[model samples]
Target: MAKHGFKAIEALDITYVLPTYARARVAFVKGKGARLQDTQGRDYIDFGSGIGVASLGHSHKALQKALKKSAKTLIHTSNLYYIEPQAKLAARLVEYYKRGDEGKPNTQKSDKSKWRVFFGNSGAEANECAIKIARKYGQKDGRYKIITLDSSFHGRTIATLKATGQDKFHKHFAPFPDGFVRAKDLSDIPNKLDSETAAVFIELVQGEGGINALDKKQVQHLAKILKKQNILLMVDEVQSGIYRSGEIFASKVYGIEPDVITMAKGLAGGVPIGACMTRLIDVFESGDHGSTFGGNFLSTNAGLAVLKTLEKMRKDRTLESTTKYFHTKLDSVLERYPAVFSKRVGLGLMCGLQVRSEEIFSQILSACLRHRVLVLRSGGNVLRFLPPLTITKSEIDEGFTRLLCALKELKISQTQKTAQKSKNPK
Candidate 1:
C-alpha cells in the first residue's frame, strides 16, 4: 500500500501517463453498485458512473461471473471464425431494436433479417462505422455530406471528431476528413441539405452537450423529411442507450426509426465494447471494415451477461420504475433549490442540472467532491448526474443529502466571501 494515498499514485501517473485529462485528486480503488471507495478508504456516492459506462454498476455479479467464465475458456480469437457469443450478442441487440417497433400501428414492423451489427471497441469506432456506411451507401449517387446538429458530440477519432458539431473540438485538429456539415437547428437542416447530403446524425439526448434532449415532434418530422429524400438517419446512442434514457435506445424514445444506430459506453456494463447496428447491411462488404479485438470472447460474453440482466430488468419493469423514481428525486431537488439551479435537463437516469453560471457549477462540483460524492460536468454550466441504473432509492436519498449539505456549505462560504470583499473594498 502507498503511504501517501492518492498522492503516490498521482505522482506515478503524472510521470508515466499522458496528461490528457485534468483529473480530480481522488483515486478510487473499489466500487459496488452506486458507491465507490477511494485509495484513502473514504466512501463516496457515485453519481457519474464513469461518465455513464457502468450501467450495471461496479463489480456486478453477472459481469464478474461472465468475466471469470470467459477467462477460464477463451479470451479472444480471429473474427474469421464464427463466435457464438458475438453472434448471440448481435442478435440480442437487433431483437431490442425490433422490440421498440412493436405496437406502432403506422410504423412497419422491424424485419430482423434486414438489420446487421458490427462490433467495435468504443463509441468512436462504432460511429466511424456508421459514418462509413452512410458514405458508402451514398457513393453511387455522389452524396457524401452528413449533417449534424450543433452542440452534438460524436467521438474523438479524426472522422468522428469531424462529425462532432462543436467548434471547440475542431481546433488544433486541422484538415479534418471532409463531408460533415453542421445544421443550426431543425429549421436550418433543410437549408443545409442539398444533393451532397447523405445522412443526418444526431443524439436524441445530447449527453456531453449539456444533456439536452431534442424535441420529439421535431425529430419525428426530421426523420420523415430524411426518409422522403432517401437520406440515412443515424442515431448515436453511446451515452443515452441501454436504459439510460429509460429505453433500450434513445431513438426509440423519440419514436423514430434510424437507418443506423451506434452504441457503446454502457453496452457491456463496463466492458470495452461498441456496436454499429444498421438496416443497410449490404453497404459494407466483408473486407470493407474489421476490428481485430472486436466481439472477442470476453467482451461478447460480458455483453451477453449485461443483456441478460437488462432483459430481466425490462421484463420486471424495474428499469421503468427506477427511472421514474430518479426523475422524481431530481424534480424535488430542483424545487427545493430553485435559485441555485436554473433548470433540469435530460431524460431518465441521464440528467443534468443547469446552474446560474459556470463559476457556480465549478464551485458546487468541487463541493460535491469535498463531501464525498462523485458527479460530472457537461456543456460548461451543467452539473450532470449519471448514476448506475441499479442505484436504489436509499442511495438516491443519501446522495441528495450529501448534495444538500454541499449546497449549504457553499452558501455559507459565499456569504463569508461577500463580507470579506465588502470589508476589503479593493
Candidate 2:
C-alpha cells in the first residue's frame, strides 16, 4: 500500500523514523527521466536528482533490466567467496580510472603499485576504509592524524562527522574521535602539517560546501608538498566523480594523481555502491578489514550497467553537450538576476548560484516547490543544481524558467515588504 498524503501524517507513525532530516511534506510516488510525481500526482522537474544519486534519471530501462536479470539469476552470495559481477565491475572501474592516465611518466613507486578497488555500501563506508588504510600504513611511524578542510563535508558517520571540519555539524556530537586535525584556514594548512600527519583528505568539488571547486594550481601545489612528505593525498569524489565534471574524475581535470580516491554517488546508477581505490592497494593485508554486503552480485551488476551506459553516452558526447548548454543557460540566469544571486560557481552539471540572503533563499525554495520545480540548497546560501546527466536541453530550459519565476516572486515579495516598512517609519 502507498503512503497517505500529508493530511494523514498525524494518524501515521511517521515519528517512528528518526528525525534526522527536515523532509518535505509531499511524498514522491513515481519518477521518470528527470521528472517526479508525488502521491497527489503533482509533477515536478527534478533538478536535485536525489542529491546526485539517480545518475541515469528515474526508472531508467537499462538499470531496471540489469537489476531484474540479476535478481532472477543471483541476487547475492557471501563476500566469503568471489563473485563474477564484483570482479568484472572492479576491473572496469580500474580501467576507467586509467582512461587518460596513459603515456604519463611511470617513475614513481605509486605508478608501479597501480590502483585497486575496495567496495563498500556508501560513501561514508568507503571513506572509513580509507581512514583505516591510512592509519594502517602510517602506524609504524606514529602518524595517525587525518586532515580535512574547513567548510567541507565527508559524511554523516561519527568519525566522518569529526572529519567534516564544519562546526555546525559538530554541534551536540561532543567528544569526537581523536587524531583528526581540522584546517579552518586554508592558507595555514601547510603550517599545520607535521610528521604525525597520515593523510590529507579533500574533495575536488565540495558538493555540500556551496558547490565549491578549488583552483587547480593551488591543489596541484598542495599535492606536490604532500608527496614530498609522504602524506597520502586522498580525494572524496562521492559527488563529483563519474563524468559529472566533464571528466571521469574531477582530479583528472587538475591533472593530479591522488594516492586514494573514494567514489559512490553515481557509481551504480541508483544502487547503493561505494568504492575507494588506492595506489597502495596492498596497504590493508588480509584479516585487517572487511564488509559482508560490500560487493554483492546485484549492486556490482548495476555498476556494470551504469558504466556501459556511460560509455555509450560518452561516444555520442551527450553529457558534455548538455552540460555546456546548461552552463550557457546559467550565465543567462546570472545576467538576469545579479541582485538576487551574487555569482555562479562549479563546472559541468554540478552548479551553484550564490544566493544573496538566507531569507531570500527560503522564499525562493518555497516558490520553486509551489511551482513544481525541485532544487536544493548548499552551504546555507547556494542554490545547488545537480540535474541528471541525461536531462534534455528542453528540460533544462523549462527548469531554469521555473527557477527564475521563483526568484522573481521572491524579489517582488521583498520589494513590497520594503515599501510597506518604508511608509510605516518605525
Candidate 3:
C-alpha cells in the first residue's frame, strides 16, 4: 500500500468526512518548543506557532501543569454557582488591565467602572458578544450600525462575518445581518455615524487582512470623533493581544483606548477561551447575554496560569524586550530581502512581510516547508510570522537561516527558468 515514499493506506485509511487543509505533504506527530517532528522523524521550525495560538510554545510545562492539576481536582462547574478560579482570574485580569504597566494606578474610573467582562469559547464568539454589546448599547435610541474597516477581519459568525470588511467571506451567506457598514478612510467614518450607529469596531492591526496596521493619528482622530458623537468604539484584539503585538494589547500600541476590546488566541497558552472587556459597564442587563461554557473552572484556571506567566514576563521585562528584539530582527530580515518584500508591518512579534504577489508568497511558504521552517500566509500576499514570545535568539537565528536558504533556492529556480527560456529561444 506504500507508493514511493508515501503510504497509500495512510492516504485512504480514513473516511472522506474530514475537510482538507490544502493537504500538507507531511504529518507532524510531536512538537516541542518551536520545533515540530513529523511521522517521518523530521523536525521543522514552527514560526507560525499554530497560527499565533501557541504563545508559550508546544506543551509548556507551566500550562501543562495547570491543565493536569485542574483536571485532577475539578473540571466543569457550570455558571450556576460560584467558581473561585473564575473569580480570581477575573480579578487578576481586571487588576492587570487597571494597573496598566504594573504598579500603575487604576486609571479607569468608578463611573467607567460600569465596564464589565464577558467570556466565550473562541475568537468568533468573543466578537459575537461584542456585536451584541454594540447592538444593545444602541438599542436605547434605535442605534444599530457598526462601522468596520475595509479589508478588516472580525470572525466567521453570521454577525461578525457581516461585520467583516472583505466581500470574499460574504459568499453563499448572502443577506447577512444588517447594520454593518464599511469605511475606506478614517476621515470618511464620521459621516457614517448617526443615531442608528451603535459602535465603530476596528482592528488596531488587521491581522488576517494582510496585517495592515491602522495609522496612529487616524485612530486617535477617529476615537475623538466617536467620543464626541457619543458612539462606542470597539476594538477587535482577538489576534493582536496577549503580548503577541509586543504590548499586552494593540490598543496600548496604537495609543487609543477603545470603549470595548475583544481577545481570545494565546490567552490561556492554547486553552480555548475568548474574552470581551469593555469600558462601557452599564450596557448590558442581567439576562441580556450568556454562554454555557464561558469562564468554566478549568478554562479559568488556565487563564490564571497564562496571566501568571505574563506577570512573570512583565516583571522580568522579557515580554517587552522579546517583542522589541523580534521586531528588530524581523526588520533586519526584511531589509535583506527588499527585492522579494516591499516592507514589514505589525508591532512586536506579530509581523508580516509584503511580498510581490500571492504566488510569490506561496512559493516562499513552500520553500520554508521544504527547509523545515513553518510559517503561515495572511490576507493574499503577506506572510505572517508569529513565533513564541519565549523563543530563543539561537532559534530565531536558525529560523532566519532556513528562510534565507529558502529565498536562495527560489532565486536559483527563477534563474533556471530564465536560462531555460534563453536557450529555448521561443
Best by TM-score: 1
Q: What ranges in model 2 sit over 4 Å off?
A: 1-3, 9-13, 101-113, 412-426
Per-prediction TM-score to the true structure, in the order listed: 0.94, 0.93, 0.91
Give the Cα-based TM-score of candidate 2 against the true structure: 0.93
Error of 1 at 253 (Å): 1.2
Residue 15's C-alpha lDDT in candidate 1? 99
Q: Model 2 over residues 51-92: C-alpha lDDT tens digits? A: 988888899998999999998999888788989999998888
lDDT of 3 by residue, 94-157 (tens): 6666655455756765433445688888989999989998888888889999998888889888
Give the winner by TM-score: 1 or 2: 1
For model 1, the run of ten residues with the poorest summed lDDT: 100-109
Number of the top candidate by lDDT?
A: 1
How far is 69's C-alpha from truth in model 3 (Å)? 1.1
Worst 10 residues of 3 by lDDT: 1-10
Candidate 1 local lDDT, 1-426, one digit each (tens): 235678888989999999989998889888888999888888899999999999888889999999999999999987989999999999988877777334222245455458899999999999999999999999999999999989999999999998898989889988998899998877789889899999999999998788998999999998999999999999999999987887788888888889999999998988899999999977888799999999999989999998888878877888888888878877777766665676899998899888765656777988999999888988877889999988888888899889888876655346645654554455
In order, candidate lDDTs are 0.87, 0.84, 0.80
Residue pairs whose backbone atoms clash in candidate 2: none
- Give me the overall lDDT of model 1: 0.87
Task: Tell me the lDDT of candidate 2.
Answer: 0.84
